[model samples]
Target chain A: MSFKPDHEIYRRRFSRNLGVGLCLVAFVMLGFFLTVEKVTRGNPLDALQGKPYVAAPVAP
Target chain B: MTDIQAQATPAEPGFGDFVQLLKPRVMSLVVFTALVGLMVAPVHLYPVAGFSAILFIALGAGASGALNMWWDADIDAVMRRTRNRPVPSGRIQPCEALGLGVALSGISVVMLALATNLMAAGLLAFTIFFYAVVYSMWLKRLTPQNIVIGGAAGAFPPMIGWVAATGSMSLEACLMFALIFMWTPPHFWALALFMKEDYSNAGVPMLTVTHGRRATRVHVLVYTLLLVPFAMALGWMSIGGPVYIAAAAVLNVWFVVGAVRIWRRDEVQAEADKYAVEKAFFRFSLVYLFAHFSALLVEAVLRAQVYGV
Candidate 1:
């Protein structure tokens, strides 16, 4: 059992969006993966041990 | 944050409730496929890295479940099948589920990024987002096509595993993704067919609730038709071999025949045995998915030992 489409309108949107979302999501996924790989691969604990993504506030 | 924490103090949740929050059955499938994905990839993972990667992925899956339970508690309370879940049973508060889910999501993603490549971590992130936000929050309540789109969340673990091993996606990885994505509709719909009253009671607008059983039966046949080729095709891809192809052929023949029987059932025939065909088909759906993925793993092992691939 599944959804009853209100009409063919969602049917069309569903089909189109599945394709669009697949590609968009895949692209972002790959981009994020590569970026993280570049930043983190050398050391598992680097985030903990090294400088943060943002600099700590300077002492007054 | 303080207000939410305040609510958790009044009720003590046992260890089992926390375990239940993870939805272990679903996690096991995630672990299985992700392991297969990693093992079959051209590049292998270190034992420790592999273990860690899988741990994080399972956590990600658990995170999605927690978030889903948190969000769906209202409708869940209405469905007999889901009414006893931790949140609705009052074993844990919604805020606790939400907090646990969000915390696990961040921890799993960050740790996976550390343990594997960015790609695997990113895929895990998308998977959680897809299940929690896209599937749970939006598509589920709004469409009868909910499972169709939401199935993608379940489909990502294998690909994430492959990425973990190779630090990149490949044809084999995509095929694994396609295999699960294609398999989800029929699998879930089969359950929906038998559990129609639960959907009706819960006001969930499932296919049986909206389209009626006849249409759902036909849809099962049609989707099963679509699924077979995609499944068999993987036999010819980098991941495929004689063993996998042979297993796929046998499994799919049974699957299609079952779907056809389901499609052929009329109200009279179905009611005679209380949806026996539908129920049988639902049972087969589980075997159908597990068999295919297991076949892939078997082929990989065979090749490793025999063919030296």
Candidate 2:
């Protein structure tokens, strides 16, 4: 198969691909941060370590 | 090869078109109001969890928007305002929009459950269902009171935000919900007054179409009058302060005055003046909601500073 010159379709497809890629990356980052925050702030890690999980103090 | 390429090539949609299907403008309102709801709650949310909660809420809102566009593509094609939307304009396929909406809806709801509490997630799920199925598919085409009931879907975000923070509901949250719920009818009716032809042509039964323009005008005034109490009541809540109350008092007076002007005008006066009052009211309605929420946010900050919550 022979390759043709770059077409308008390729350009549009590239934009879509790039956008989807960025969104996926953002989602992964958000998930990572959320997990970190959950483990650090709460007693999730303590429970994981077989310690009695003390509930974090919540505001009224 | 050239012929094959020619046959395959159509107006392929860009990234922005997909974004448009999400109704970014509506999502912006959802984000802002939800943020206010989260911030004003007495409970403290870890920064990351708070951010994730808002993001999932926004995504859920965006998913509903995509579903609305997919379902309403036919009517959207007829309406001047919505004619150029992604699905209607054929830039994006209807099925693609539907798939995106469904996927995003599921993802957002599940992710929200992980990031926040089940209560918030449940509310988010219900909001998406209400907007995509109940409001978009049923109420919109069936009745003139569509936006009235449909407005609840929009009003849910703030309450969901509060729930995400506190894992429960509160009077303050309900007050926030009521504020948007009451404001929606007047805000949309003001738009209906000017965009009367769009709804009628699209075969969507808006108040301006079923009832007369005069009736819509009256409804706008009536709803605006009703909205004032809810707006004022929020000021007395824990989230509220002197700042919110003063802002609410001034904004409500201005809003009611605008609604009254809209009510007093007839088609002749409206047409002669190019629907300036109606148009102005529509614009101000956006500011009205934003300012009210901003006032609540300011009050929340002040309370935090004074009492160290």
Candidate 3:
């Protein structure tokens, strides 16, 4: 049996799948940035290296 | 000839249907007020943090919207205004909305804690619970003063934003909360005056349905009168500036005049005018909120730019 590329089901489901896919991608990016912000600002790694993690003074 | 294709196609839910489950218009208000709240706080947040904080709060608000749809599906189906919502119209399953609300509520609260602070997260969690359970399930069906109390749920975002930024509460944040809380009654009562039939048909005890339109109109004026002090006080607070005070003065005058007009009209006169005054008041209430918040935001920007606060 041959599969049709433009089936009705495919057309119906495409947008929903694409939206969920985009949201997941965006969430991953948000997580990456959040981690980077936390680590860079406080230098949490300093604590792991036997040093205190002093929070950087935040800008107004 | 194409028997398989001729079979009736079940109505399939789409992305937009799911988004509708989130009540995007309400989410817009949530996003705007929360942004203003975050901006006006004394401490500045890193751009990414600020964005994430607002996004999570919006998500929490949207999650509650979904839960409200789930709970209110019956009343929603009866009400003309909400009859076509995703769940009530059968595009999305009630269980799906429930699951989405629960999952997003958990995710938003946890992510907010991670992105901002525990206080902000706690407030978001409480807000979701207040909206979904206390307001939607209990207060909405039980009392004419439903939105009056339920307005607290919508009033929370700015306080959450403030807490997210300052990691604590202040009078400024409370003032912003009070402004929205006070504004909600008149805003909704105006809508209720026009949409009385929907609330009556849905068996919801809106003030217009229970206390008569005349009483609802009086309540609108009284609430509008009460709301003015909160708005003016916020203007005089540290966050308030010349811009905000001026805006508040003008907006309050217009708002009070609108409320008084609403109060003075009898149903016969209102019907003669096709409820024009009520509809105008409803539209202006949206502007009243947006302008007030915008003024606060403008003051924050000016302070940051000029005084470098």
User: Which candidate should be chosen as best, given lDDT against the real structure?
Assistant: 3
lDDT of 2 by residue, A1-60 (tens): 988988987888899999999999998998887886676565456667777555658989
Task: Give the range where candidate 2 chain A is weakest over 10 consecutive residues by summed lDDT.
Answer: A39-48
Model 1: residues with Cα > 4 Å off, grouped in runs: A1-60, B1-10
Model 2, residue B298: C-alpha shift (Å): 0.5
lDDT of 2 by residue, B95-177 (tens): 99999999999999999999989999999999999999999998999999999999999999999999999999899999999
Global lDDT of model 3: 0.94
Interface RMSD of each: 15.2, 1.5, 2.0
Per the 3 Å backbone cut-off, how many clashing residue pairs does candidate 1 have?
Answer: 4
Question: lDDT score, residue B88, model 3?
Answer: 88
TM-score of 2: 0.92
DockQ of 3: 0.43
- The CA lDDT at B248 in model 3 is 96
When 2 and 3 are scored with DockQ, the better candidate is: 2
lDDT of 3 at A55: 59
Candidate 1, residues B169-191, lDDT tens digits: the string is 78889888988998999988989
Scored by TM against the true chain B, the candidates give: 0.96, 0.97, 0.97
Least lDDT summed over 10 consecutive residues: which range in candidate 2 chain B? B1-10
Q: After superposition, how far is residue B33 of candidate 1 from its true place, in Å?
A: 0.7
Candidate 1 A-chain TM-score: 0.44
| Tens-digit lDDT string for candidate 3 (A1-60) | 987678565665888999999999999999998887686674545666766566568999
TM-score for chain A, candidates 1 onward in order: 0.44, 0.59, 0.53
What TM-score goes with each of the models?
0.81, 0.92, 0.92
